[model samples]
Target: MDQETLPPNKRELLKQISSPHNPKEESLGSSSHKPSPKPFWSPLSLQMSIQEYELLKEDDEQCLRKYRKQCMREMHERLSFGPRFNGVHELDSGEAFLEVIEKEHRLTVVVVHIYKAGVKGCEVLDRCLDCLAAQYPSVKFCRINAAVSGAGEHFSDNVLPAVLVYKAGEMLGNFLAITQHFSDEFLATDVEAFLTEYGLLPEKDFRAAGDEADVE
Candidate 1:
Protein backbone atom coordinates (compact mmCIF):
# COMPACT_ATOMS: atom_id res chain seq x y z
CA MET A 1 0.00 0.00 0.00
CA ASP A 2 3.12 2.33 -0.23
CA GLN A 3 2.85 3.19 -3.92
CA GLU A 4 1.80 6.78 -2.94
CA THR A 5 -1.36 4.92 -1.73
CA LEU A 6 -1.47 2.66 -4.78
CA PRO A 7 -4.75 4.33 -6.06
CA PRO A 8 -6.72 7.37 -4.70
CA ASN A 9 -9.90 5.33 -3.91
CA LYS A 10 -8.01 2.46 -2.35
CA ARG A 11 -5.93 4.84 -0.18
CA GLU A 12 -9.14 6.55 1.09
CA LEU A 13 -10.74 3.23 2.03
CA LEU A 14 -7.68 2.13 3.90
CA LYS A 15 -7.63 5.44 5.89
CA GLN A 16 -11.39 5.06 6.96
CA ILE A 17 -10.75 1.46 8.02
CA SER A 18 -7.80 2.53 10.16
CA SER A 19 -9.80 5.20 12.14
CA PRO A 20 -10.87 4.46 15.84
CA HIS A 21 -14.63 3.99 16.68
CA ASN A 22 -16.04 6.32 19.42
CA PRO A 23 -19.08 5.04 21.40
CA LYS A 24 -19.99 8.58 22.59
CA GLU A 25 -20.23 9.90 19.02
CA GLU A 26 -22.43 6.96 17.97
CA SER A 27 -24.74 7.45 20.96
CA LEU A 28 -24.99 11.24 20.24
CA GLY A 29 -25.83 10.56 16.62
CA SER A 30 -28.57 8.02 17.54
CA SER A 31 -30.14 10.35 20.12
CA SER A 32 -30.17 13.36 17.75
CA HIS A 33 -32.10 11.33 15.09
CA LYS A 34 -34.84 10.14 17.50
CA PRO A 35 -38.32 11.84 17.53
CA SER A 36 -39.17 13.82 20.73
CA PRO A 37 -41.70 12.37 23.23
CA LYS A 38 -45.04 14.11 23.85
CA PRO A 39 -45.40 15.98 27.16
CA PHE A 40 -47.46 14.26 29.89
CA TRP A 41 -50.59 15.93 31.47
CA SER A 42 -49.97 17.30 34.99
CA PRO A 43 -52.08 15.86 37.86
CA LEU A 44 -53.75 19.22 38.54
CA SER A 45 -54.66 19.66 34.90
CA LEU A 46 -56.15 16.12 34.77
CA GLN A 47 -58.29 16.79 37.89
CA MET A 48 -59.56 20.07 36.47
CA SER A 49 -60.58 18.35 33.24
CA ILE A 50 -62.53 15.71 35.18
CA GLN A 51 -64.34 18.39 37.19
CA GLU A 52 -65.25 20.25 34.00
CA TYR A 53 -66.68 17.09 32.48
CA GLU A 54 -68.79 16.41 35.59
CA LEU A 55 -70.23 19.92 35.58
CA LEU A 56 -71.20 19.67 31.93
CA LYS A 57 -72.87 16.29 32.57
CA GLU A 58 -74.88 17.76 35.46
CA ASP A 59 -76.00 20.68 33.32
CA ASP A 60 -77.24 18.33 30.61
CA GLU A 61 -79.17 16.24 33.16
CA GLN A 62 -80.85 19.34 34.58
CA CYS A 63 -81.91 20.47 31.11
CA LEU A 64 -83.33 17.03 30.39
CA ARG A 65 -85.36 17.06 33.62
CA LYS A 66 -86.79 20.48 32.80
CA TYR A 67 -87.74 19.32 29.32
CA ARG A 68 -89.51 16.24 30.70
CA LYS A 69 -91.50 18.34 33.15
CA GLN A 70 -92.56 20.72 30.39
CA CYS A 71 -93.73 17.83 28.24
CA MET A 72 -95.73 16.30 31.11
CA ARG A 73 -97.44 19.62 31.81
CA GLU A 74 -98.40 20.00 28.16
CA MET A 75 -99.77 16.46 28.07
CA HIS A 76 -101.81 17.00 31.20
CA GLU A 77 -103.30 20.18 29.81
CA ARG A 78 -104.29 18.42 26.59
CA LEU A 79 -105.81 15.40 28.36
CA SER A 80 -108.02 17.23 30.83
CA PHE A 81 -111.60 16.71 29.57
CA GLY A 82 -113.74 17.35 32.64
CA PRO A 83 -116.38 20.09 32.76
CA ARG A 84 -115.68 23.23 34.81
CA PHE A 85 -118.11 24.87 37.17
CA ASN A 86 -117.24 28.23 38.71
CA GLY A 87 -119.79 28.49 41.54
CA VAL A 88 -121.64 26.30 44.01
CA HIS A 89 -125.02 25.00 42.83
CA GLU A 90 -128.11 24.59 44.98
CA LEU A 91 -130.34 21.50 44.67
CA ASP A 92 -134.01 21.97 45.58
CA SER A 93 -135.05 18.36 45.26
CA GLY A 94 -133.58 14.95 46.04
CA GLU A 95 -134.08 13.93 42.41
CA ALA A 96 -131.88 16.79 41.23
CA PHE A 97 -129.13 15.77 43.66
CA LEU A 98 -129.26 12.22 42.37
CA GLU A 99 -129.04 13.41 38.80
CA VAL A 100 -125.97 15.56 39.54
CA ILE A 101 -124.16 12.68 41.23
CA GLU A 102 -125.00 10.04 38.61
CA LYS A 103 -125.05 12.01 35.37
CA GLU A 104 -122.03 14.32 35.79
CA HIS A 105 -118.82 13.65 33.94
CA ARG A 106 -117.15 10.52 35.29
CA LEU A 107 -113.93 12.41 36.00
CA THR A 108 -115.71 15.22 37.79
CA VAL A 109 -115.45 15.27 41.63
CA VAL A 110 -118.80 16.21 43.12
CA VAL A 111 -118.92 17.62 46.64
CA VAL A 112 -122.31 17.97 48.30
CA HIS A 113 -122.97 19.94 51.48
CA ILE A 114 -125.99 18.93 53.57
CA TYR A 115 -127.26 21.51 55.93
CA LYS A 116 -130.29 22.97 57.69
CA ALA A 117 -131.00 26.70 57.27
CA GLY A 118 -130.44 27.66 60.90
CA VAL A 119 -127.60 25.22 61.72
CA LYS A 120 -124.67 26.71 63.61
CA GLY A 121 -121.99 26.26 60.85
CA CYS A 122 -124.21 25.78 57.80
CA GLU A 123 -123.83 29.37 56.52
CA VAL A 124 -120.09 29.38 57.13
CA LEU A 125 -119.61 26.11 55.22
CA ASP A 126 -121.73 27.46 52.38
CA ARG A 127 -119.51 30.52 52.09
CA CYS A 128 -116.34 28.40 52.19
CA LEU A 129 -117.71 26.09 49.47
CA ASP A 130 -118.48 29.06 47.26
CA CYS A 131 -114.89 30.17 47.47
CA LEU A 132 -113.58 26.64 46.91
CA ALA A 133 -115.86 26.21 43.87
CA ALA A 134 -114.41 29.34 42.34
CA GLN A 135 -110.85 28.16 42.97
CA TYR A 136 -111.44 24.59 41.81
CA PRO A 137 -113.58 24.97 38.75
CA SER A 138 -113.09 21.33 37.83
CA VAL A 139 -115.03 20.19 40.90
CA LYS A 140 -118.81 20.45 41.11
CA PHE A 141 -119.94 21.93 44.45
CA CYS A 142 -123.57 21.57 45.51
CA ARG A 143 -125.67 22.31 48.60
CA ILE A 144 -129.00 20.76 49.62
CA ASN A 145 -131.11 21.27 52.69
CA ALA A 146 -131.47 18.23 54.92
CA ALA A 147 -135.27 18.28 54.64
CA VAL A 148 -135.06 18.60 50.86
CA SER A 149 -132.77 15.52 50.54
CA GLY A 150 -135.78 13.22 51.29
CA ALA A 151 -133.54 11.55 53.90
CA GLY A 152 -134.28 13.97 56.70
CA GLU A 153 -134.64 11.17 59.20
CA HIS A 154 -131.16 9.84 58.47
CA PHE A 155 -129.50 13.29 58.21
CA SER A 156 -130.77 14.86 61.44
CA ASP A 157 -130.07 18.44 62.63
CA ASN A 158 -127.24 17.11 64.84
CA VAL A 159 -125.33 15.94 61.74
CA LEU A 160 -125.92 19.22 59.89
CA PRO A 161 -123.15 20.83 57.79
CA ALA A 162 -122.03 17.47 56.40
CA VAL A 163 -119.83 16.96 53.37
CA LEU A 164 -120.01 14.15 50.82
CA VAL A 165 -117.45 13.55 48.09
CA TYR A 166 -118.26 11.43 45.06
CA LYS A 167 -116.46 10.44 41.88
CA ALA A 168 -117.56 8.14 39.10
CA GLY A 169 -120.82 7.41 40.92
CA GLU A 170 -118.90 6.14 43.99
CA MET A 171 -118.76 7.86 47.32
CA LEU A 172 -115.14 8.62 48.18
CA GLY A 173 -115.72 10.38 51.49
CA ASN A 174 -118.54 11.21 53.90
CA PHE A 175 -118.01 13.61 56.80
CA LEU A 176 -120.90 14.54 59.05
CA ALA A 177 -120.71 17.64 61.22
CA ILE A 178 -117.70 18.77 59.21
CA THR A 179 -117.55 22.12 60.99
CA GLN A 180 -116.30 20.38 64.14
CA HIS A 181 -112.88 20.06 62.47
CA PHE A 182 -112.37 23.81 62.20
CA SER A 183 -112.33 26.67 64.69
CA ASP A 184 -115.30 28.93 65.27
CA GLU A 185 -114.12 31.13 62.38
CA PHE A 186 -112.26 29.66 59.38
CA LEU A 187 -111.24 30.76 55.91
CA ALA A 188 -111.63 29.11 52.53
CA THR A 189 -107.99 28.02 52.74
CA ASP A 190 -108.83 26.01 55.85
CA VAL A 191 -111.50 24.06 54.07
CA GLU A 192 -109.29 23.54 51.04
CA ALA A 193 -106.45 22.19 53.15
CA PHE A 194 -108.79 19.91 55.04
CA LEU A 195 -110.21 18.41 51.86
CA THR A 196 -106.77 18.02 50.34
CA GLU A 197 -105.53 16.18 53.43
CA TYR A 198 -108.27 13.62 52.98
CA GLY A 199 -107.36 13.20 49.27
CA LEU A 200 -110.80 14.47 48.32
CA LEU A 201 -109.63 17.33 46.04
CA PRO A 202 -107.34 17.45 43.05
CA GLU A 203 -104.29 19.61 42.59
CA LYS A 204 -105.32 23.27 42.44
CA ASP A 205 -105.08 24.85 38.96
CA PHE A 206 -103.80 28.28 39.79
CA ARG A 207 -103.70 29.33 36.17
CA ALA A 208 -107.40 28.72 35.63
CA ALA A 209 -108.33 30.29 38.94
CA GLY A 210 -106.30 33.37 38.09
CA ASP A 211 -107.94 33.70 34.71
CA GLU A 212 -111.40 33.46 36.28
CA ALA A 213 -110.49 36.11 38.82
CA ASP A 214 -109.27 38.39 36.06
CA VAL A 215 -112.57 38.03 34.22
CA GLU A 216 -114.51 38.99 37.32
Candidate 2:
Protein backbone atom coordinates (compact mmCIF):
# COMPACT_ATOMS: atom_id res chain seq x y z
CA MET A 1 0.00 0.00 0.00
CA ASP A 2 1.36 3.50 -1.14
CA GLN A 3 1.41 5.96 1.73
CA GLU A 4 0.02 8.89 -0.26
CA THR A 5 -3.07 6.91 -1.41
CA LEU A 6 -3.97 5.60 2.12
CA PRO A 7 -6.42 7.38 4.54
CA PRO A 8 -4.88 9.83 7.04
CA ASN A 9 -5.70 7.59 10.07
CA LYS A 10 -4.31 4.52 8.35
CA ARG A 11 -1.16 6.40 7.39
CA GLU A 12 -0.69 7.50 11.00
CA LEU A 13 -1.22 3.93 12.26
CA LEU A 14 1.33 2.66 9.76
CA LYS A 15 3.80 5.30 10.94
CA GLN A 16 3.41 4.18 14.54
CA ILE A 17 3.88 0.50 13.63
CA SER A 18 7.11 1.26 11.65
CA SER A 19 8.58 3.52 14.42
CA PRO A 20 11.68 2.21 16.30
CA HIS A 21 10.79 0.69 19.75
CA ASN A 22 12.77 2.83 22.23
CA PRO A 23 12.50 1.34 25.76
CA LYS A 24 13.06 4.79 27.35
CA GLU A 25 10.12 6.27 25.42
CA GLU A 26 7.62 3.74 26.82
CA SER A 27 4.36 5.08 28.42
CA LEU A 28 4.77 6.43 31.96
CA GLY A 29 2.18 3.94 33.33
CA SER A 30 4.10 0.97 31.86
CA SER A 31 7.50 2.05 33.28
CA SER A 32 8.75 -0.27 36.11
CA HIS A 33 11.12 2.42 37.57
CA LYS A 34 8.28 4.71 38.77
CA PRO A 35 8.60 5.26 42.49
CA SER A 36 6.22 2.99 44.40
CA PRO A 37 3.07 4.83 45.56
CA LYS A 38 3.62 6.18 49.03
CA PRO A 39 2.17 3.61 51.42
CA PHE A 40 -1.40 4.60 52.31
CA TRP A 41 -1.94 4.87 56.09
CA SER A 42 -5.61 5.00 57.12
CA PRO A 43 -6.46 7.06 60.20
CA LEU A 44 -8.11 4.12 61.98
CA SER A 45 -5.20 1.76 61.30
CA LEU A 46 -2.67 4.31 62.59
CA GLN A 47 -4.71 4.84 65.78
CA MET A 48 -4.91 1.10 66.46
CA SER A 49 -1.13 0.71 66.09
CA ILE A 50 -0.51 3.53 68.58
CA GLN A 51 -2.89 1.99 71.10
CA GLU A 52 -1.15 -1.38 70.86
CA TYR A 53 2.24 0.22 71.45
CA GLU A 54 0.98 2.06 74.55
CA LEU A 55 -0.46 -1.16 76.03
CA LEU A 56 2.83 -2.98 75.54
CA LYS A 57 4.76 -0.14 77.16
CA GLU A 58 2.47 -0.12 80.20
CA ASP A 59 2.94 -3.86 80.72
CA ASP A 60 6.73 -3.40 80.57
CA GLU A 61 6.60 -0.69 83.22
CA GLN A 62 4.55 -2.82 85.59
CA CYS A 63 6.97 -5.73 85.24
CA LEU A 64 9.91 -3.44 85.92
CA ARG A 65 8.30 -2.13 89.11
CA LYS A 66 7.72 -5.64 90.48
CA TYR A 67 11.30 -6.62 89.67
CA ARG A 68 12.66 -3.57 91.49
CA LYS A 69 10.60 -4.31 94.59
CA GLN A 70 11.85 -7.91 94.69
CA CYS A 71 15.45 -6.71 94.38
CA MET A 72 15.03 -4.27 97.26
CA ARG A 73 13.55 -6.97 99.49
CA GLU A 74 16.44 -9.33 98.75
CA MET A 75 19.02 -6.64 99.43
CA HIS A 76 17.43 -5.79 102.74
CA GLU A 77 17.55 -9.44 103.84
CA ARG A 78 21.21 -9.77 102.92
CA LEU A 79 22.29 -6.61 104.70
CA SER A 80 20.41 -7.27 107.94
CA PHE A 81 22.61 -8.46 110.83
CA GLY A 82 20.07 -8.65 113.64
CA PRO A 83 19.50 -11.86 115.63
CA ARG A 84 16.41 -13.84 114.64
CA PHE A 85 14.58 -16.38 116.83
CA ASN A 86 11.58 -18.41 115.64
CA GLY A 87 10.33 -19.84 118.97
CA VAL A 88 10.27 -19.07 122.67
CA HIS A 89 13.20 -20.36 124.76
CA GLU A 90 12.43 -22.07 128.07
CA LEU A 91 14.87 -20.85 130.72
CA ASP A 92 15.93 -23.52 133.20
CA SER A 93 17.32 -21.04 135.73
CA GLY A 94 17.13 -17.36 136.62
CA GLU A 95 20.78 -16.98 135.57
CA ALA A 96 19.89 -18.22 132.09
CA PHE A 97 17.13 -15.60 131.89
CA LEU A 98 19.60 -12.91 132.92
CA GLU A 99 22.07 -14.09 130.28
CA VAL A 100 19.49 -13.75 127.50
CA ILE A 101 18.51 -10.22 128.55
CA GLU A 102 22.08 -9.02 128.81
CA LYS A 103 23.79 -10.99 126.05
CA GLU A 104 21.24 -10.53 123.25
CA HIS A 105 21.71 -7.84 120.65
CA ARG A 106 21.32 -4.33 121.99
CA LEU A 107 18.46 -3.67 119.62
CA THR A 108 16.63 -6.81 120.65
CA VAL A 109 13.41 -6.56 122.68
CA VAL A 110 13.30 -9.32 125.28
CA VAL A 111 9.88 -10.51 126.48
CA VAL A 112 10.12 -12.87 129.49
CA HIS A 113 7.01 -14.63 130.68
CA ILE A 114 7.35 -15.81 134.28
CA TYR A 115 4.74 -18.54 134.39
CA LYS A 116 3.95 -21.50 136.67
CA ALA A 117 2.50 -24.78 135.46
CA GLY A 118 -1.13 -25.56 136.40
CA VAL A 119 -1.80 -21.85 136.95
CA LYS A 120 -5.14 -20.57 135.67
CA GLY A 121 -3.72 -18.67 132.66
CA CYS A 122 -0.06 -19.63 132.54
CA GLU A 123 -0.53 -22.33 129.88
CA VAL A 124 -2.58 -20.04 127.66
CA LEU A 125 0.04 -17.29 127.95
CA ASP A 126 2.78 -19.71 127.00
CA ARG A 127 0.89 -20.70 123.84
CA CYS A 128 0.39 -17.04 122.96
CA LEU A 129 4.10 -16.34 123.38
CA ASP A 130 4.89 -19.18 120.98
CA CYS A 131 2.78 -17.58 118.29
CA LEU A 132 4.32 -14.16 118.89
CA ALA A 133 7.83 -15.58 118.75
CA ALA A 134 7.16 -16.93 115.27
CA GLN A 135 5.81 -13.57 114.10
CA TYR A 136 8.51 -11.30 115.58
CA PRO A 137 11.86 -12.90 114.92
CA SER A 138 13.77 -9.84 116.12
CA VAL A 139 12.16 -10.03 119.56
CA LYS A 140 13.57 -12.61 121.98
CA PHE A 141 10.68 -14.42 123.70
CA CYS A 142 11.48 -16.55 126.72
CA ARG A 143 9.58 -18.46 129.39
CA ILE A 144 10.67 -19.37 132.95
CA ASN A 145 8.62 -21.17 135.56
CA ALA A 146 8.04 -19.01 138.60
CA ALA A 147 9.35 -21.78 140.85
CA VAL A 148 12.64 -21.97 138.97
CA SER A 149 13.09 -18.21 138.48
CA GLY A 150 14.91 -17.97 141.87
CA ALA A 151 12.21 -15.48 142.99
CA GLY A 152 9.26 -17.78 143.45
CA GLU A 153 8.27 -16.02 146.65
CA HIS A 154 7.94 -12.70 144.85
CA PHE A 155 5.99 -14.15 141.86
CA SER A 156 3.27 -15.96 143.80
CA ASP A 157 0.35 -17.74 142.17
CA ASN A 158 -1.44 -14.42 142.01
CA VAL A 159 1.26 -13.11 139.66
CA LEU A 160 2.05 -16.45 138.08
CA PRO A 161 1.58 -15.16 134.52
CA ALA A 162 3.65 -12.01 134.81
CA VAL A 163 5.36 -10.55 131.77
CA LEU A 164 8.62 -8.59 131.94
CA VAL A 165 9.85 -6.57 128.96
CA TYR A 166 13.54 -5.79 128.84
CA LYS A 167 15.90 -3.91 126.53
CA ALA A 168 19.67 -3.84 126.99
CA GLY A 169 19.35 -5.50 130.40
CA GLU A 170 16.93 -2.84 131.70
CA MET A 171 13.32 -3.61 132.46
CA LEU A 172 10.97 -1.50 130.35
CA GLY A 173 7.73 -3.07 131.47
CA ASN A 174 6.52 -5.13 134.44
CA PHE A 175 2.99 -6.44 134.04
CA LEU A 176 2.14 -8.68 136.98
CA ALA A 177 -0.82 -11.00 136.72
CA ILE A 178 -0.89 -10.22 133.03
CA THR A 179 -3.77 -12.65 132.48
CA GLN A 180 -6.06 -10.03 134.01
CA HIS A 181 -5.85 -8.08 130.76
CA PHE A 182 -7.19 -10.89 128.54
CA SER A 183 -10.42 -12.85 128.32
CA ASP A 184 -10.60 -16.42 129.50
CA GLU A 185 -10.44 -17.73 125.93
CA PHE A 186 -8.04 -15.60 123.88
CA LEU A 187 -6.05 -15.90 120.67
CA ALA A 188 -2.50 -14.92 119.74
CA THR A 189 -3.83 -11.81 118.03
CA ASP A 190 -5.39 -10.70 121.32
CA VAL A 191 -2.11 -11.01 123.12
CA GLU A 192 -0.34 -9.14 120.32
CA ALA A 193 -2.89 -6.36 120.50
CA PHE A 194 -2.39 -6.02 124.23
CA LEU A 195 1.38 -5.71 123.96
CA THR A 196 1.11 -3.30 121.06
CA GLU A 197 -1.17 -1.06 123.12
CA TYR A 198 1.68 -0.42 125.56
CA GLY A 199 4.26 0.03 122.80
CA LEU A 200 6.05 -3.05 124.07
CA LEU A 201 6.35 -4.78 120.68
CA PRO A 202 8.66 -3.58 117.95
CA GLU A 203 7.53 -2.73 114.45
CA LYS A 204 6.99 -5.73 112.21
CA ASP A 205 10.13 -6.64 110.33
CA PHE A 206 9.72 -5.74 106.65
CA ARG A 207 11.84 -8.61 105.35
CA ALA A 208 9.94 -11.17 107.38
CA ALA A 209 6.61 -9.81 106.24
CA GLY A 210 7.70 -9.94 102.61
CA ASP A 211 8.83 -13.53 102.94
CA GLU A 212 5.49 -14.50 104.49
CA ALA A 213 3.57 -12.79 101.74
CA ASP A 214 5.57 -14.69 99.15
CA VAL A 215 4.71 -17.91 100.85
CA GLU A 216 1.03 -17.09 100.81
Candidate 3:
Protein backbone atom coordinates (compact mmCIF):
# COMPACT_ATOMS: atom_id res chain seq x y z
CA MET A 1 0.00 0.00 0.00
CA ASP A 2 1.07 3.56 -0.66
CA GLN A 3 2.36 5.57 2.31
CA GLU A 4 -0.66 7.89 2.15
CA THR A 5 -3.09 4.99 2.59
CA LEU A 6 -0.95 2.94 4.99
CA PRO A 7 -1.31 2.98 8.77
CA PRO A 8 1.83 3.86 10.59
CA ASN A 9 3.51 1.43 12.97
CA LYS A 10 3.94 4.17 15.53
CA ARG A 11 5.93 2.19 18.01
CA GLU A 12 8.28 0.77 15.43
CA LEU A 13 8.87 4.14 13.73
CA LEU A 14 9.34 5.84 17.06
CA LYS A 15 11.83 3.15 17.96
CA GLN A 16 13.62 3.59 14.63
CA ILE A 17 13.67 7.42 14.60
CA SER A 18 14.47 7.73 18.27
CA SER A 19 17.33 5.27 18.02
CA PRO A 20 16.15 1.95 19.47
CA HIS A 21 19.70 1.46 20.56
CA ASN A 22 19.29 4.35 23.03
CA PRO A 23 18.43 2.59 26.26
CA LYS A 24 17.11 5.33 28.54
CA GLU A 25 14.32 7.08 26.56
CA GLU A 26 12.75 3.82 25.33
CA SER A 27 12.69 2.51 28.90
CA LEU A 28 11.24 5.83 30.06
CA GLY A 29 8.51 5.62 27.42
CA SER A 30 7.70 2.06 28.49
CA SER A 31 7.88 2.77 32.20
CA SER A 32 5.98 6.08 32.04
CA HIS A 33 3.01 4.61 30.19
CA LYS A 34 2.50 1.34 32.09
CA PRO A 35 0.34 1.57 35.21
CA SER A 36 1.59 0.24 38.51
CA PRO A 37 -0.11 -2.79 40.02
CA LYS A 38 -1.88 -2.24 43.30
CA PRO A 39 -0.37 -3.52 46.53
CA PHE A 40 -1.52 -6.75 48.20
CA TRP A 41 -2.65 -5.35 51.57
CA SER A 42 -5.64 -3.52 50.04
CA PRO A 43 -8.13 -6.31 50.85
CA LEU A 44 -7.42 -5.54 54.53
CA SER A 45 -7.03 -1.82 54.20
CA LEU A 46 -7.49 1.33 56.27
CA GLN A 47 -6.03 3.84 53.91
CA MET A 48 -9.11 6.00 54.14
CA SER A 49 -8.71 9.22 56.07
CA ILE A 50 -10.89 10.17 59.02
CA GLN A 51 -12.49 12.75 56.80
CA GLU A 52 -13.51 9.98 54.43
CA TYR A 53 -15.03 7.85 57.19
CA GLU A 54 -16.89 10.87 58.55
CA LEU A 55 -18.17 11.70 55.09
CA LEU A 56 -19.42 8.20 54.37
CA LYS A 57 -20.88 7.92 57.86
CA GLU A 58 -23.24 10.74 56.97
CA ASP A 59 -25.64 8.06 55.73
CA ASP A 60 -26.79 6.85 59.13
CA GLU A 61 -29.12 4.06 58.00
CA GLN A 62 -26.51 2.42 55.80
CA CYS A 63 -23.87 2.79 58.50
CA LEU A 64 -26.16 1.23 61.11
CA ARG A 65 -27.07 -1.66 58.84
CA LYS A 66 -23.39 -2.36 58.21
CA TYR A 67 -22.65 -2.28 61.95
CA ARG A 68 -25.55 -4.60 62.79
CA LYS A 69 -24.39 -7.20 60.30
CA GLN A 70 -20.88 -7.09 61.76
CA CYS A 71 -22.13 -7.55 65.30
CA MET A 72 -24.36 -10.48 64.39
CA ARG A 73 -21.41 -12.27 62.86
CA GLU A 74 -19.29 -11.89 65.97
CA MET A 75 -22.16 -12.95 68.23
CA HIS A 76 -22.81 -16.01 66.11
CA GLU A 77 -19.15 -16.97 66.37
CA ARG A 78 -19.15 -16.67 70.17
CA LEU A 79 -22.39 -18.60 70.48
CA SER A 80 -21.06 -21.25 68.14
CA PHE A 81 -17.93 -22.01 70.13
CA GLY A 82 -19.80 -21.80 73.43
CA PRO A 83 -23.18 -20.83 74.81
CA ARG A 84 -22.23 -17.32 75.82
CA PHE A 85 -25.54 -16.34 77.39
CA ASN A 86 -28.73 -18.09 78.60
CA GLY A 87 -31.14 -15.62 77.11
CA VAL A 88 -32.22 -17.98 74.33
CA HIS A 89 -32.05 -21.23 76.25
CA GLU A 90 -33.72 -23.02 79.15
CA LEU A 91 -31.53 -22.25 82.17
CA ASP A 92 -30.24 -25.29 84.08
CA SER A 93 -29.23 -24.79 87.69
CA GLY A 94 -26.68 -22.03 87.18
CA GLU A 95 -24.96 -24.03 84.43
CA ALA A 96 -25.53 -21.01 82.24
CA PHE A 97 -24.03 -18.84 84.95
CA LEU A 98 -20.91 -20.98 84.88
CA GLU A 99 -20.07 -19.74 81.41
CA VAL A 100 -21.47 -16.29 81.96
CA ILE A 101 -19.34 -15.72 85.04
CA GLU A 102 -16.12 -16.94 83.52
CA LYS A 103 -14.17 -14.51 81.39
CA GLU A 104 -11.71 -15.96 78.93
CA HIS A 105 -10.64 -12.39 78.67
CA ARG A 106 -8.04 -10.22 80.32
CA LEU A 107 -10.83 -8.37 82.18
CA THR A 108 -13.87 -9.33 84.25
CA VAL A 109 -17.53 -8.82 83.42
CA VAL A 110 -19.39 -6.43 85.67
CA VAL A 111 -22.98 -7.41 84.99
CA VAL A 112 -26.45 -6.69 86.30
CA HIS A 113 -28.21 -10.08 86.23
CA ILE A 114 -31.89 -9.16 86.14
CA TYR A 115 -34.77 -11.50 86.89
CA LYS A 116 -37.88 -11.97 84.81
CA ALA A 117 -40.80 -11.06 87.05
CA GLY A 118 -42.85 -8.32 85.48
CA VAL A 119 -44.24 -6.93 82.24
CA LYS A 120 -41.06 -5.00 81.66
CA GLY A 121 -38.84 -8.01 82.23
CA CYS A 122 -38.27 -8.61 78.55
CA GLU A 123 -37.77 -4.97 77.80
CA VAL A 124 -35.22 -4.73 80.56
CA LEU A 125 -33.36 -7.86 79.48
CA ASP A 126 -33.44 -6.94 75.82
CA ARG A 127 -32.19 -3.43 76.27
CA CYS A 128 -29.35 -4.64 78.45
CA LEU A 129 -28.50 -7.64 76.29
CA ASP A 130 -28.40 -5.73 73.03
CA CYS A 131 -26.50 -2.90 74.63
CA LEU A 132 -23.87 -5.22 76.05
CA ALA A 133 -23.87 -7.28 72.91
CA ALA A 134 -22.94 -4.28 70.78
CA GLN A 135 -21.18 -1.90 73.11
CA TYR A 136 -19.42 -4.22 75.56
CA PRO A 137 -18.42 -7.22 73.52
CA SER A 138 -15.65 -7.91 75.98
CA VAL A 139 -17.94 -8.36 78.98
CA LYS A 140 -20.72 -10.90 79.43
CA PHE A 141 -24.29 -9.84 80.25
CA CYS A 142 -26.96 -12.31 81.38
CA ARG A 143 -30.45 -12.45 82.90
CA ILE A 144 -31.85 -15.40 84.89
CA ASN A 145 -34.73 -15.50 87.31
CA ALA A 146 -36.29 -17.42 90.21
CA ALA A 147 -37.15 -20.25 87.85
CA VAL A 148 -33.82 -21.52 86.60
CA SER A 149 -30.86 -20.58 88.73
CA GLY A 150 -29.41 -21.79 92.02
CA ALA A 151 -29.88 -18.33 93.48
CA GLY A 152 -33.44 -18.17 92.14
CA GLU A 153 -34.48 -21.20 94.28
CA HIS A 154 -34.09 -19.14 97.44
CA PHE A 155 -35.27 -15.70 96.33
CA SER A 156 -37.86 -16.98 93.92
CA ASP A 157 -40.82 -14.55 94.47
CA ASN A 158 -39.39 -12.81 97.45
CA VAL A 159 -36.75 -10.28 96.47
CA LEU A 160 -37.05 -6.74 95.20
CA PRO A 161 -35.39 -5.59 91.92
CA ALA A 162 -31.66 -5.50 92.47
CA VAL A 163 -28.42 -4.87 90.56
CA LEU A 164 -25.44 -7.13 91.08
CA VAL A 165 -21.89 -7.42 89.76
CA TYR A 166 -19.43 -10.20 90.30
CA LYS A 167 -15.78 -10.75 89.70
CA ALA A 168 -14.37 -14.29 89.94
CA GLY A 169 -17.65 -15.45 91.54
CA GLU A 170 -17.04 -13.05 94.44
CA MET A 171 -19.36 -10.09 94.60
CA LEU A 172 -17.17 -7.09 93.77
CA GLY A 173 -19.92 -4.52 94.28
CA ASN A 174 -23.68 -4.01 94.08
CA PHE A 175 -26.46 -1.42 94.04
CA LEU A 176 -29.39 -3.41 95.52
CA ALA A 177 -29.99 0.19 96.31
CA ILE A 178 -32.77 0.40 93.69
CA THR A 179 -36.46 0.57 94.56
CA GLN A 180 -39.66 0.18 92.57
CA HIS A 181 -39.29 3.42 90.73
CA PHE A 182 -35.80 4.03 89.35
CA SER A 183 -34.26 5.76 86.39
CA ASP A 184 -33.01 3.78 83.39
CA GLU A 185 -30.32 6.39 82.96
CA PHE A 186 -28.87 5.57 86.36
CA LEU A 187 -29.01 1.84 85.67
CA ALA A 188 -27.12 2.12 82.43
CA THR A 189 -24.66 4.92 83.04
CA ASP A 190 -23.94 3.98 86.63
CA VAL A 191 -23.19 0.37 85.80
CA GLU A 192 -20.99 1.50 82.95
CA ALA A 193 -18.97 3.62 85.30
CA PHE A 194 -18.88 0.87 87.91
CA LEU A 195 -17.62 -1.66 85.41
CA THR A 196 -15.00 0.79 84.27
CA GLU A 197 -13.92 1.43 87.85
CA TYR A 198 -13.19 -2.23 88.39
CA GLY A 199 -11.52 -2.45 84.99
CA LEU A 200 -14.00 -5.10 83.90
CA LEU A 201 -15.35 -3.27 80.87
CA PRO A 202 -14.61 -0.66 78.28
CA GLU A 203 -16.41 2.62 78.43
CA LYS A 204 -17.36 1.86 74.84
CA ASP A 205 -16.52 -1.13 72.72
CA PHE A 206 -19.00 -0.67 69.94
CA ARG A 207 -16.35 0.60 67.57
CA ALA A 208 -13.98 -2.10 68.77
CA ALA A 209 -16.59 -4.74 68.03
CA GLY A 210 -16.27 -6.44 64.68
CA ASP A 211 -18.17 -5.30 61.65
CA GLU A 212 -21.43 -7.21 61.35
CA ALA A 213 -20.47 -10.35 59.59
CA ASP A 214 -23.02 -13.00 58.59
CA VAL A 215 -25.23 -13.81 61.60
CA GLU A 216 -25.57 -17.38 60.53
Judging by TM-score against the true structure, name the best candidate: 2
TM-score of 3: 0.43
Please report how far candidate 3 places residue 172 from its true position, in Å: 1.6
**Candidate 2: regions farther than 4 A off:** 1-70, 74-81
Report how far off residue 28 is in candidate 1 (Å).
90
lDDT of each: 0.86, 0.85, 0.54
| Better model by TM-score: candidate 1 vs candidate 2 | 2
TM-score for predicted model 1 compared with the true structure: 0.62
Instruction: Mark the 10 consecutive residues where model 3 has the least summed lDDT.
Output: 82-91
- Note each model's CA RMSD in angstroms: 10.4, 7.3, 15.5
Between the candidate structures 2 and 3, which one is better when assessed by lDDT? 2
Tens-place lDDT per residue, model 2, 1-216, is 789999999998887888785545665456557567876898899999999999999999978867887898667656555677879999999899889988888778999999887899988888899988887888999999888888989998887699999988899999999888888998889989999999989777676676676675
Candidates 2 and 3 compared by TM-score, better number? 2
